[model samples]
Target: TILGLWSLASMSFGVFMGRYVNTEYMQSYWRIRAAGSGLSGVDAAASEVASLGDEAAIISFTEGTIVDDRRTIGYVAKGTIYCVAPVMRRAMPSAPVEFWAAGVGCCERRSNFDCGSARLPGGSLTALTYTAEGDKYFAEAVKEAASVYSITVGKRAQRVFFEGDPAVFIDDLWREAVVAAILAAVFHFCTCIIVSTALQKAGVRWVGGARGLLPGDELAAEDMLLRGGAARGKDKSSTHDHLRNVLDPRASWVEEKPERSCLGCGPRHYWVFHSLEEQHVEEIEKQIWFSESRTLDQGCDPSFFDRVVIAEDGGFNEVATLMKSINWYRYFSAFLTVGMIVYNICYILKSDAHMITSDDAGGHMYLISETVIKPPLDFVLRMLHIEGTGRFNANVVVPIMEIACLLLVLVWVTVLAVEAALVEPRSRRRWKNLSRVLFNFPPAIAGFSSMSLLHYVNPSVLIEHIVEYSHRRASLEPVLAWTKFVVLRLLCLVIGVDAFLMKFRMTAQYINQEDIDMRCVCQLAGFILQLIGIVPVSIIVRERLLRAFFGGEDASEDIEEKAKEMTYHALLCREMYRHSQSDLDFVVMVLSFNDVDFQGLMLNMNSSKMGPRTSLEVKGNAQVTKKNSVEGRKSLEEDLENDFLEVARAASISKARRGARPGATTRKPREGRAGGGSPPSPICP
Candidate 1:
């Protein structure tokens, strides 16, 4: 969508530029042919050229005036070489000069004219447009040459002629228009293919499109195994009864192992399932139930939602830290946005629009009338209520600011996109610090806000001209504005619709997948709205920050305070997710009896007797591949007992020492610590 809009904008700009150039082509040049020999006709044409204001004339001089191997005067100023050769009536010591044939970079020697077809037969020069600066330079060059050759010249004879035709200039304008249209087409299709392919691969399907079932769906489908027992060659009643027995909590036996042979600890109870298949079936059912229940339960786990405030890791600490590290870029973007807004606005408000002017091939004055001639620095002056207008060109200054802002925003968006879209929420503990930044400043919003910076800093010539021209030309503004307005809002609408289509498939984690799509859709949207939305996205972001930290009061807070609040919010979410996962794991383990029941079975099973408890235990331990030999089982039991005793004794000693100390209380280990070691055994006192 962004590419389509960009293409349309490019094509529109090309058409506008082409039309403007064509109009100028009709009025900007005159065909002034020499009437007689010896430079007389050239002089007549130069004198009459003043009537056509801001227009150039092409002068075809007579062959008699052509001077082969003529001495050309070259003057270097502002890093541009201005060259001119004298057009004289005759080659005499006192010969009067008609005019100077002018062109840039046409002289090999500072003193000789070595440029173009001036020395060829039937050669001629084109007249240069009148300008105060160009006039001064020509006068200076003529003066410098007079001192060396001792030839007299006056202001009347200072008329300059450039060595080119105006027809080529018109051709270039049309060429630019055609090229721009072509480029826009290429960009549009390429981006469409890329975005479409990515979306398809990521499982974003159209409505009613066929797709493989999710993990949760497959588990839910397993209900058919019991419902249609004929598929498994079993009676439906028996299968139903078997499933019910497996699901019943009382069906699992509870065994209490005595302390003496176990680990010198008090008796501990463990669940034991009837058979391995029953345990496996129970695990699947619990998973399916959890999945179904979670869909209905919008609330987070009570352990997470019941908290009064978020922890440092929960949400706010990361936001706080990230704001500090990234705030300057945000501030600068806000400033740039303001400057651009003002520049664009003032262009509309101000009378006598300033133009971007350059010299064409014919040394004719080429003007880009649709440009903001007043720099951003000028706006700064107006804001400060300075005495005079600011002349500093912000074109150079603003782009530098843009570069700095772009780099920061680019890095921030990249990391955030990767974390939110690629990294799992639970697995993000390893990337906790970086993940905090992601949550605080979502990748979608960050990219959306910085879209202008991306557009402004882009080196695309067509976009550059469109931006510059759109501000100056009032006629172009409404059309351009409406086009962009529709494009961006339409993009939002498309994304919103796509999200709706995938609503059931999208989890909290997968919601981050929309970030890339949002970035692509909304990136150019910023550039489009810069004029209309005077309040930058940064300012809005700042407002959100203030609300999060200071409860929406119009009050200032320290960076550290904001940082703390932000990271606190981030960590709070993390903590909530942790609790939710805990609930899910608990639900699955309790029904399956795999977590605790296996411990008792491993401890009490006798290798010699194939009794009911021993047979059930053997069938339940599906993960254990090799049946332990009688000697191996006895040795394993002794080793497990010894290790359990050592851990229990250590925990007991630690508890005793804490009790003996003054004002020392038992402290639980921090949640989510990596490799904190298996929590003290439940058997420990």
Candidate 2:
């Protein structure tokens, strides 16, 4: 969640600041400061000087020529003229109209060229846009609010200003900053709210015990156990009668111990079957009933769920935190855009669309990187390596891969769209719908193309599946979910390489100063944001991944961690799953009501670990195995076949007590088990 906030904050601040300031402002400031030094200082002298009409024009800086893309033939020359005056609709009757009338080429123009902090000389006046040429100026009539002036003091050139009130530039910086803060807040809240829904559905409902279970679930679990009796070769009627007698609440001789205990969600709860293999529904239902009934009789603590970790554990925050690492990639992607933004700002700094310097004309590419983007694209001659100016741009391979990927995506989108427009929801879903996925892809790809800052993101499909459920993972969900961090890691590597090459090239060409400034500004904010938010979230992501994939140094810690996953799935698939909007209900729906067999898959995974066999073996438990039993069935295991199936079935009881371990076949001498009982070795050794 914090990472989500960081992503939004950096983007918001960067965008607003970029919009408010540009090289145009820098160029104007540089010129004026140089002028002010000559007249002693700009303070009293700049305000005292004002030029009206053609008087605003001065001799050319470099013969009045500005470069277009820094090439000689790009544009012809003009003088370096400064226009310091207010914007007006028409020229005054007294002064020359040619210098004031800009031929309507200007209206609400937006570019880096327009931003400036310079104030007009002496009285209030601000410079307006030039029409067709830099020498042509327009002063629109305006009253007081805020004002600006473009004052340039070259070594020999003079300062020119037109007098009137111009007040549009006051306190603009403060406004942009405020908007960025507001946007950050909006983004934070929006992320929190959307992710909350996914969390609510996947909460820690499977923490064994009577917690988070309804009354009916208990009965279903009891039934599940009774059905498992046939696998033991007992007569159905006799097993039913025997199970009934043992389960009776009023029977004095009825065992206080549940007949089944398997590796499950929490500590060895009696009602949860402790078998190595998944049991039938009847056995599962029976355990649920028995656990609930026993919990009721014992008056178990109602306060177990009171702890925040116990109640709100294992939900949105966990999954979303992992997903947030993706933003590191997005951060680098945003960094690449600085190069282009700097290029545009430089364009505004030197000259506009009308004219350019002679020395900088005749170049084919903008920003002086012609060789970077044009060579391989020419189609006439083939070159594998771009050696000169084209070196800065992507090589031939990048575009080829990009095109192939783009075509693949286009085909997917087209097929999905047709399926959506022509078929029913159920039918369309069969072929993989693009509704959730394709919606974000178009914008993401566009951002990739233009190198724009992309902040649009959502939780992955795997996270969605865990929160909801579907038989088939959404078409692209597994890819995104499983590879979330992998992609971020890859992007970080790519950006690092690109940054090195770009810095080397830019430094050599002298075209990288503006780019470096922009990148530095963006990164400074990014680094600060990471310190405040992303760092903590990244730790959380790393911890979760480590705990899940690589167990801590201790061996038992491995089982404990895997147990949580098992328990989650167990609670998810309990028989009465549909009744309470429970975990299993979500899984069933995600599977599209068992169209795909997650049960076998989940069972194989859940029970695969050699789970803790005794109460002592499980962490957070202080005591040994304590099973108060029904006397008659106590010796019942002595009569079984002790085959593979039976061994696994009997393994649950092997760790419970010394009495059950004696008849249990092929038991291993597990050293630390409660009451010194050996755990069952399910496989023959």
Candidate 3:
């Protein structure tokens, strides 16, 4: 596919060059240098360049890549900068080469004189193909595309310039080669590619790109990449936005992994979320499961749960600390919410007098009792039948109503503030914790506050939090979200009518209808954006909100399921090693996995930890058995007595023999083969 794409792009470039292309543009560019070419040596070129000025003559290729965006060559020589082929301002920088300032060019255009240094005496373009392949394949390409040039520049300087683009036959091969390939790809695999990418982002395991299958260790564990059996190699600072890459003890640079031949290999291996074949599906499931386990290890490895009892004991305080640590953003949210409520109230108060007429008859305030107060006021007005009458004591009544509303906002904000402060310990510096809360007050005063509560939390922070609580404690979403939405609802109400009371200033009388409409749209837009964003983010975060809220063994089961899925999600999202050691045994012990289906996997990890009963308990038991073996001790004593008696008898016999044969010559040493036979056996009962 990559080759096809490259070929297609190459062909597109070819078609662009053929038939309709203006090679004259390049030639003309060279023609501009014609003014300087007439001069001889460095000084002459310099003088001519000065005379021509900067626009016509090339000054610097500091910005040009060796192979420029237009696939034209550029370089810096002495104090001169040259654009060998000058045109195609819209082109992108080509792939780089070891030599030259700008990287090498990609599109093969007959540049009149792109490589001024390499041009020959005759003003002609020269194509240089320098590859270890010895240019055998491209030799013909060179002959047809361009001629070779060898230009020499003396230390004394020289003025050699190209005149203009030369005439040439248009090449249309790019149509059949490039167009066909590109169209075929777009027609056949465009949707597939997009879908695959989307699924990959959603934590689905897939294999392609002509790479080998399941190359473990090549990828970081978090990515859940699989290595091709012992084969082809492969595979952030911000805490909120980054994946937990540091969790793995063993990490290696992905570049270090040996590249695998995906298409060139004997057979390609792949793992898909849902394979066409059931066997493939199962294999992918295993890979997914394996990857998932490693991903989980990034945070709470199963080891924590394996020793659940111990962890529970040690972790109690940590939990308290984590939950108690105020999000800080929440405080800001409350502050903003209260301020919004206050602003709304003030707008109502200021508008209380009534609508003023040019005729000088006092009237009811404009936009004063629209959304919240309209229903109650309308009823009273209807009963009094003074709906269209001039202003009454509404000025006096409205301030009291504003006070009530202000009081409610104050109470709500105060309660939230107290709870947050109480739960949060004041271990950190007062000022440091207050920084986020202190958020640009001047800016807020100048209408710089976020329009929505969703904006209050950083996207990264939200994501990290979502992932962090994926399988754990209950979410405080209801508590956290309600106040903000209430603010939303209030704003909506304001917009539903034409109050336009977004940030009511005490001095301001009425909000313009347009301002209200715009603010309302922005709020709606923000909501829509957040909603769309969560679609992808939710896949990655996968918080078990239900399990978090509902505490039970059933919820625990769901949590376990979510944990595995999230682990898999991490594998897909992160670029990590394929094979990381995970305590699958511990997972089996704690998680309610279908043992019948996972028996083999469970056994695999279980076997790794299985050898013998060597725990302290087992050793203590073994020691006790030895101490209680009375019969065995008696037998040991008998055996020792027999050995001693034999030794004593042999010593006595040696003494008797020595006494009888003091003069006897020492006997010749007897020769015997090892294990050939024992001495002649004496029959004994």
Best by lDDT: 1
Candidate 2 on 126-191: residue-level lDDT in tens? 332232224322222111101222222222222223213222222233344455656766876786
lDDT of each: 0.41, 0.32, 0.33
Per-residue error for 315 in candidate 1, Å, reads 56
lDDT of 3: 0.33
Predicted candidate 1 versus true structure: per-residue lDDT over 32-80, tens digit per residue: 2221111224442244434443333444454355542255677788887
Off by over 4 Å in 3: 1-279, 282-372, 378-685
Of the pair 1 and 3, which is ahead by lDDT? 1
Lowest lDDT block of 10, candidate 2: 66-75
Model 1 misses residue 487 by how many Å? 60
TM-score of each: 0.23, 0.24, 0.23
| Model 2: residues with Cα > 4 Å off, grouped in runs | 1-404, 420-685
What digit string (tens of lDDT, one per residue) describes model 3 on residues 1-685?
Answer: 5346756865765566542323423333334334342322222112233344323333322222222223333333343333333211123322112122111232233343443332334432211112122223233322232233222222322122222231221112223434555665575466556665664443323243344333321232223332333222331123111112211111121111223654443222322332213333443344335433432422212222221122222222232222233344534544554464345434333333232212222234454434356566667887898765333433343334434554564465455445535653442322222221222121222221112223324457455544545544335565555555456545434432222222232223223342334445444433333233323332222234323322245445455665543443222211111121233322212121122212222222234334421122222222222222455335533543453345335534755665643453322223473555543321110
